[model samples]
Target: MRPAMLIRLALLALLVAFIVTPETFAPVFQPFTKNGAPAIYTQTSLLSLTLSHLAIVAVATVAATLFSVGLAIIVTRPFGVEFLPLSRSIANIGQTFPPVAVLALAVPMFGFGPIPTLIALFLYGLLPIFENALTGLTNLPGNVSEAARGVGMTGRQRLTQVEFPLALPVILAGVRLSVVISLATATIGSTVAAKTLGEVIIAGLLSNNTAFVLQGGLVVGVLALLIHDAFVMFERSIARRTGRLY
Candidate 1:
């Protein structure tokens, strides 16, 4: 009903149409190509490339979330507090190291494919989620935590029932950032023979086909926007349920 929601739905529909029946829109891209060059990327189905691209990002983001959140939980515990700096350094490794370098290093051991890409993405996505989780877990209202303890809740029970739930919106915010970054970065995985939307962009670059480049970039940009919006909606929903939303 809202204009923003309507626009998002329209974008989603157009993205699906582009992926499922790209050739039908070739005429729209005709002006961007040479007089006789193909106006759309046809070597691989856009739908397949999109799906593969999402799969890689999803897998990497999930892996990063689990590791980062778990590490955050550990470091927040009394016994694990001393390890906080070490944990921060470990999470920072991904951001400090170049993704291309990670890919190059991983290729020999993992071989050219999604595996190397997954390694690069997984490492790259860690810092945001880790930092957010740490912030959320550490910044809880003192009274709420005291109340949980006053109710005779064990540390583990309080964490599982109260702390984690309250912190979820913040954690989700980090996950959203990680996912968006991974979506764009995963395109680089194509250099190592990974199946991704980057294939279209790379082919276009090699052939000097603006149409191909535009199609690839447009699809990736739209996907990132849609995913970002989806995360925002989910984060807001969680915040509302947790009484964190105004």
Candidate 2:
């Protein structure tokens, strides 16, 4: 079988095992338990935080997309090559910063709750967004760009009409990456008392209750997969409907 096919099969097996494993449905998988009346409200209470985390991710996606695309455009010119070094440096720097440390630092300024989590996720989300946007813009077909220029298309017109549309696939691929990372990291935000499904996992950890952790983790993992699939569907639909694909 082809390597890609094999890999896909393996991934499917892994996903199935994770979902079907006995550990997933255990009422309580460990030596701990929530107090009586803890009920399912624990999970419900966390919904607000989870939504807040997603909100931050949305904000981050929008803000980072604009900055990244703009930065890509700026750095593409010969006169603007100087910005390339700076852009690379900043992108690298952002990735190197420990996300938890960024969250901790934000706490003093933002003061508890979800704000710090948002800022950390925002910073963490930028590198991929910027890098992908930069790559997509740079790798655009030269003939297409030249054709536009030959027709007397202004720089802005060429960018909007030719470059940007063709670059969308690559750019969206980066966005898909950011979305997955943001979902995973939102769980970490629970450590900072930020609202999210992470609350389930953390609560389970603190009290040594595996069931809660599994439940929260299972929900989160499924949600991440669903979101990833949604993006794939969206990207494919765009490609087909736009005639980017045959």
Candidate 3:
């Protein structure tokens, strides 16, 4: 009965419509199609494209999360503190170069398809997660660490038990940002022969099929919103459990 519940239901219904009966929504796109053209984007299944898009983003996000969080942890440690600036510079390099450029440069070595796209997405998604992980690890309350040390906890134990739990919410915030950004950016992968919603948009552009463009754009937009909302909910849950408020 809550607004949140209703919104979730609505999103679920919309996703089902897109997956199960995309044609049911085709009529709305009729104005975009040419006089003699089909009003629907029929070259590929929207569901399949959506799944592939999410899979690419998921893999890239996972890779970014591991590398960024690991680097952040390493640079924050006593042994590796000196490398903080270098790590930061490396992470920033990805953001400095646009994802499109990364793809362009990567394609030469990686060849066309998802590999180049994966590399671009992985590089592009690193900064926020890295920064957030660094902040979370470095900003722990002094007393907490002292208490952890006083309890005869080893450095590893303190890190795993006392520090990480408190830092998880902040880290999740970064991941949320990374994921949403990756979702939007993943569409560009189609330019390099990767299968994505962007393929539909590109086809529409080349053939002058407005319906295809609209359909692809709408699907991608809806997916981004859906995934973002899911992350928002997850971040909130983490914050609440961690005794933090976003």
TM-score of 1: 0.99
lDDT of 1 by residue, 114-134 (tens): 999999999999999999999
Could you give candidate 2's per-residue lDDT for residues 186-237 as a string of tens digits? Answer: 7888787767778878877876666677667766676577667767767777
Which has the greatest TM-score? Answer: 1
Off by over 4 Å in 3: none
For each of the candidates, give the backbone clash count.
0, 1, 0
lDDT tens per residue, model 3, 71-132: 99899889999999999998897799999999989999989999998998899989999999
| Residue pairs in candidate 3 whose N, alpha carbon or C atoms collide under 3 angstroms | none
What are the TM-scores, per candidate, against the unseen true structure? 0.99, 0.80, 0.96
Write the candidate numbers in order of decreasing lDDT: 1, 3, 2
Q: Ten consecutive residues with minimal summed lDDT in candidate 3? A: 12-21
* Candidate 3 TM-score, C-alpha based: 0.96
Q: Which candidate wins on lDDT? A: 1
The whole-model C-alpha lDDT of candidate 3 against the native structure comes to 0.88
